[model samples]
Target: MATVVPPDLELFLTGWLRSNITDVDGLQVGHRTPDGYDGSYPLIVVRDDGGAQSADRVVFDRSVGVNVCGWTRNSPKDCRDLAARVYGLLTGEPDILVGFAEGSSVCAVVPDGCNGPYPVTEDAPYCRYYMTVEYSAAGIRQS
Candidate 1:
């Protein structure tokens, strides 16, 4: 008997990572899990804002490998403060264009990461939690 087969999970995950990390520069997501839930974890980077395990509370670990560094949420006045920190590493005043789902009203920097006078929303989804997952499990146990 032949059972229904779902689409390639790896491909889907890969695509998801790429789409999510669009805000980061020169950053690309990858997967190397043998078997697990989706099998992926964006890169790790120092962060101050976070929410959920993934779509919620998140924090930075200052340790990760090649992956998508999560987003930041510093200062209530604007969300770009965190992004500004991330992009700041690249540009003195980064005016990044973070596009959601490849290209969807690509958000712009507020006034920290970029040289924007007054923008709205962060470029990418709040990735503080997503970035926390990206780590080097090569030395850790699976179970």
Candidate 2:
């Protein structure tokens, strides 16, 4: 069966990331992932990676990943700090409204995997961190 992208994953994740992930000033969240920062420290970019459907094709699950980056000159730990926090907040988060589902509240957000606070460049004065987050919702698709 063909997999269908969850309709509300992006919409729900944008607000979720802004409110829960980017909790500090000078931190910014956007849809596009930048190769370098635009004066925004602790930057988070959310993107729709991929998704899947249940074996019976009734439920949809999607993966939305984020790239968190921070400057690494004076305070060299910000990127990892933000990455750890984002991971903590996302794992096992329940009851998020995935609007495509029929149940009143039927969704869970969890960490799929994680990658560095590794240097963005050998000497670019920045650190890069990435995490793949999975959003799963089981419901009857709206006709």
Candidate 3:
């Protein structure tokens, strides 16, 4: 029987977020904002600040930051509402991503979901909210 190779934590995470968050219609989600992303209101960009490896190297902990930014031409409330949705989606369940790979998904003990809407940058163009989730990836092979 061919053994099913397990996916790395980082890879699994990227895929998980893409599948979970980007599925929302009209929301542009990616690891990086799309080129010429200007005018693209309701954009979500995800970044992973890779975590420290466990002593056994079978686990890791990292912070996944999602920035929900948009052109709030008329209403900042729209942006706030979108940010709330984003927060709820991310904080729903850390276990949702645990089965991504066959016996390879990260088993999260505690997912510290979401951090900031850190001072919205209204720089004449777009309004942005920065939020971060801290999650631990257990049973993930470093290799």
Candidate 4:
């Protein structure tokens, strides 16, 4: 019997956005935002919101959260704009073949919903915009 390893959506998304989204050149994409990240103006963080697997464990349905952060003391327009670009890329295509790895691949990515460009009072000079996406991935088979 082969053991199955679920796909790492965070790594896949971070890399996918970095490679595909050309709108924001030099954008920093990662799994989490540092405690006091003050180095970059615009950055993106990906989170696994969790999901379930099929009875046979061959298919996985995942919920992922994508947060776009912009450092602007005055307004959240920067974050909103960046978020729009990210949303466009993710929602533009009906079926995106995320990639193939370890005999597994992300079969589909569907845009679930999007939230606002809200002010991050705790972060003070930063604003954030978020979106939720659903990813259907094929389980990896490791013998």
TM-score of each: 0.24, 0.67, 0.69, 0.79
Report the candidate with higher TM-score, 1 versus 2.
2
**lDDT of predicted model 4:** 0.71
RMSD of 4: 3.4
RMSD per candidate (Å) reads 16.3, 4.9, 4.8, 3.4
Q: Candidate 3 — which pairs collide?
A: none
lDDT of 1 by residue, 1-143 (tens): 43222222234335544554476444444454123322122342322221112222122111211122333333222233433443443222233322223322212222322232123344443333222212111111122
Instruction: Give the per-residue lDDT of model 2 (tens digit) for 25-90.
Output: 787777875665543466777787757777866566767677777676446577777777766555
Residues 1-143 of candidate 3 have per-residue lDDT tens digits of 33223235445544655566654557766677776666456777777776666676656666777777786545566667677766665555455534444543556534455576564655546677778876666652232
- For model 2, the stretches where C-alpha displacement exceeds 4 angstroms are 1-5, 21-23, 34-36, 73-75, 93-106, 109-124, 139-143
Model 3: how far is 139 from its true place, Å? Answer: 5.8
| CA displacement after TM-score superposition, residue 124 of candidate 2 (Å) | 4.1
Between prediction 2 and prediction 3, the one with superior lDDT is 3
Q: Candidate 1: misplaced stretches above 4 Å?
A: 33-143
Task: After the best TM-score superposition of candidate 4, give how far the Cα of residue 77 lies from its true spot, in angstroms.
Answer: 1.4
| lDDT assessment of candidate 1 | 0.30
Candidate that would win on lDDT: 4
lDDT of each structure? 0.30, 0.60, 0.61, 0.71
